[model samples]
Target chain A: MATAALTLYELAAADAALRFSPHCWKTRMALAHKGLEAERVPWRFTEKAAIAFSGQGMVPVLVHDGETVTDSWAIALHLEQRFPDRPSLFGGNGAMPLARFVNGWADTVLSPAIARIIVADVHGRVHAADRDYFRTSREQRFGQALEDVVADRPANLAAFRRALQPLRRALAGDAFIAGPAPAYADYCVFGMLMWARCISDVELLEPDDPVSAWRDRLLDAFGGLARSAPTARG
Target chain B: MATAALTLYELAAADAALRFSPHCWKTRMALAHKGLEAERVPWRFTEKAAIAFSGQGMVPVLVHDGETVTDSWAIALHLEQRFPDRPSLFGGNGAMPLARFVNGWADTVLSPAIARIIVADVHGRVHAADRDYFRTSREQRFGQALEDVVADRPANLAAFRRALQPLRRALAGDAFIAGPAPAYADYCVFGMLMWARCISDVELLEPDDPVSAWRDRLLDAFGGLARSAPTARG
Candidate 1:
């Protein structure tokens, strides 16, 4: 697969280089897993027209040789099928579906929990053109103002940490969710943490948490791909 | 390979035929998945001495040709390794660790949620000798009387159902948690529901829930092994 023709539209902050969407991070890790490279174009929340060709108002849109694929899960599948010779993303067997469960858990449970704690921080970092769009849509979804959603962040943070028990227990027995090697399953949950890491200064995991250890491993994976990214705290 | 020498100690109710421990059910499904049969020995909570030979007090102790294996996860691993030619519990690849995550979720999240609603029922159904032991241990764990924990059962039931979003979302895209076919991962979560099914009359799932559909499929798996069991409702 030629890297020159692959282009990915990633969600970017006002600074552009601080890409932080959890869904997009899943795709980024997957691309790195497959040893594939793409020219990443910074996209903002209000810039729906930029990704209109994909027929969806979402970033992490992968355009490969003129074929557009949207949704992080679909893009992962696309890359896996189109580049089978690269390292297997799901590690073959029946892991793909299990990875899908991890993906679903991350979306329905992990990301939502993290969002409650960092949604306000997210609003502050989006491109200025996207701020109102981000706040209105998120406020409607959350049924409150962004600041109010994070008002009880101490409690919300505790709940978010409690919600990670399954992931913590899973990591206690293995290096990654997918086993010894960090695969798509690891990327799925890691993407959620990366979202928090990039946009918020609030500590989501304890310094000694197994999840923190697992996240550290993934942050250092693929030549420190996630670790080297700029954070709001810095 | 020899089914005759395999004996499994499963948690039994007042009536020995009504076996309902969730962890034990995970092992039972794994056994059936491998086409291996074991002599089901009825065990009760108070009968720690019975399983003491395994150096632990838990049921789901598989004594295979005098080699004792304790814990459901270890037993599943034992079955997969010992009976590799029959069928796989995990569908090979890297699914074992992912299944471990599912197992952790079931134990830490799903079972505890279901237990709050069914502990009183479980207390009522245990063998007469085990009732006091069950009540004392559970009440301490819950920090209340068995009846108190389930007093607001209607609310508890709703929370239990809500906690199943990850499983529900996973099943929406596929027939089972492990994809098209039921595997150990499905059994891990299904075991928790079976615990509720056997010992409680409360409808933990709505009839239209995808989780209900998945449960029905597993209930009918292995020649109606689970469906044939007597429930407290009956």
Candidate 2:
């Protein structure tokens, strides 16, 4: 177990790997938003042995200072806590509840909808035979089904759009998911959907909607985090 | 949208709730450990609402002060950062990595293992009807899984037990999941297993093992929380 060479607690701050994940992209953006420098390690999905030792087996794992953060949600929470100064990823004032509500709404509603498209599309497109592998793994890991997991993809996507319409209206052409300042939640959802776009199509991102403009705005807030990398000290 | 009565900014402290999760008990316990206070809202299973609003869906969802945090991993990260003055749930010195390693092990290996049995048990025994509700709701909401959507109970239970064996062994003689002082990961995993126990059989606890005793310590630590609500003031 070549575990996290440096645990999150070991480092003075987070020194993490972006891990080439869209989810990791969110954490990196949050870190950048907070102006914290982190180490970036690129990991492959096929190599289970790479992240085998860590508790959570997903991407975008952040090792703050030295503590390893496995999931993107966990990484952002860690960053927010580690760095409370500068720009806050969580919205301010009334936006907090908006942020919280949006946060939960996305977790329970949007992501799963997107995940169905993500896993099935990505797996079907990329690893056809490995679909069984993916299915079996998820079943063992989450006890969820891969095949027929969703009763209807179209309905799922439509409902997903409905659930997100509130946020889109909330965005109402605003630059972020919650408000003027992008909260951490924005980055997380952005990363996940971005992955969908990467594997599937940009149409999933919704053309001409407030979300599109909002995505552009967030990119502007972080100075195109998707395109930038850390300085040497990072 | 009653929303948060307090402007998100006005909401001092926060609440961390696991996603419809019985597993995030440890996060609540850690809040108790740090003497930090936050609101408590149980999480929802559907990912859309959680994600659209929060960013991610999985729990323990933590609203620090009022910032929306998703995933148990994130909650722990937030806790340590928000309450830096307190002793870390990970541990003091070199033990941080060991604690983290174990925590990850639990999440990746132990959690899923425990989840197989837990979800199957919960879906079948306690939530037979409710389980159908969730599946049906998913179908209605996302148009996914109209076909019974029954989890492979026997296979899952066997897999769950297989996953639990190693963890059960680790806890067989230990005082806690980690040591005398439980860490954040312990709470994450503990919350999961305990939640399973809450709705399922006590036999799942394995009294001879350390988790049985460790649970007591967590209960004690968690028994008293820095409730944002106070009965009286001078």
Candidate 3:
């Protein structure tokens, strides 16, 4: 007589005016694609103490209602269960397996390398315009040699291409990483570098690459919305 | 009254193996704790390529009946759903949230830094003795000046320590990262650095840290069970 009894709770939403982060952006982008909206809570860099309240130690945490959802993958799982009708962000049949693989690749392979590449580029050549952000936050982490990270960009970016080679191979024929449409894996990978692509000259991906092109398709789907989403927050 | 032809597949066993990874050890540890039996398949260096057949990029994957489950986190999820009677590897009412958070942190925060320190140390000082195992795998990706990576180390390791500062606060009085018993997060973090500790002459985790003590407790619970298991044919 009883089903799973899974009453869905909306996680941090876009309306909260939260500072966009790579981790959060991926999930948000997924929500955008899936047409599922949740309440947003802006996470500030200075609010380290507040953020750590979950004890999971980061943002993009989907607190389905009051109980916090940890890990982007788990959040993805939660999203699918909550919104089964719109579309399976993961494909239907064989695509689920493919999605599983690509998702893992995103989390394990592309995510970490892209993170390093993003930071170096963002805090380096791009952030020169707004030097204080880097000087304060990155300085605390990497100290003074932020210059070296920038200096070796030609080489480091080469490594980025190398790291991305696997994704390139995986997404060669498909419109998306898992299948014909963008799934959770697509958003997860795209989420990390979007901010860098947004604020800086660093083009980690290209419109030519199928993966990049697919991302453009998503942008066309969302950018009109991210742009038109009552920017004045009425 | 007829069911929807549900084939009640009574708990089938699966086989999962790692390619000389101590991180893989955690999966084995769980299998042992649950007393779940699986076939063993040991792999070599780039020998992990076969894991792709499982529709995943890397090990340690669990193949149950016909379904191939990849991603260690996903495997744990599958195991919990398929086998719910085991002593919960994810502890407490908050176990799921804790598992997701800690598991994510283990991969993101701890593994990257630990991997850097381990690779630099292993390839720099101990390359000769370890030469037999890793003939093809180079110390650095694309030969990107290990010196730059190496040069980045002192700073990187310091930042690594800073990341750990959050954990120190998390584990001040708690027996585990989330509770008294070790959970998926503990194993996840432990798995990433297992080989680093086993192979490295110097201590990887700070000797005085509560995490070190916590890790030791986990080690005792594991009791070297992860490294060796009885194979189907053995």
Highest TM-score, which number?
Answer: 1
Give the distance in Å from residue A102's predicted Cα in candidate 1 to where it truly belongs: 0.6
- What ordering of candidates by DockQ runs from best to worst? 1, 3, 2
TM-score of chain A of each: 0.97, 0.69, 0.70
For each candidate, give its TM-score against the true structure.
Answer: 0.98, 0.41, 0.44
lDDT, residue B209, candidate 3: 74
| Native-referenced Cα lDDT, model 3 | 0.54
Tens digits of per-residue lDDT, candidate 1, A107-151, equal 999988999999999998889999999999999999998989999
Model 2 per-residue lDDT tens digits across residues A107-151: 554566677655555554433433555667756644566556545
lDDT per model vs. reference: 0.91, 0.50, 0.54
Model 3 TM-score relative to the real fold: 0.44
Model 2, CA-based lDDT:
0.50
Candidate 3 docking classification: incorrect
Q: What is the fnat of candidate 3?
A: 0.00
For residues A1-234, could you state the per-residue lDDT of candidate 3 as single tens digits? 212222222122233332335566667777777776666665544345655656755666676546667666667777777778766665442233333334444555555455455565444333233346545667566554556545666676676666565455445535655445556656766765554554345667655766576667666665554333222123
> What is the C-alpha DockQ of each candidate?
0.82, 0.02, 0.03
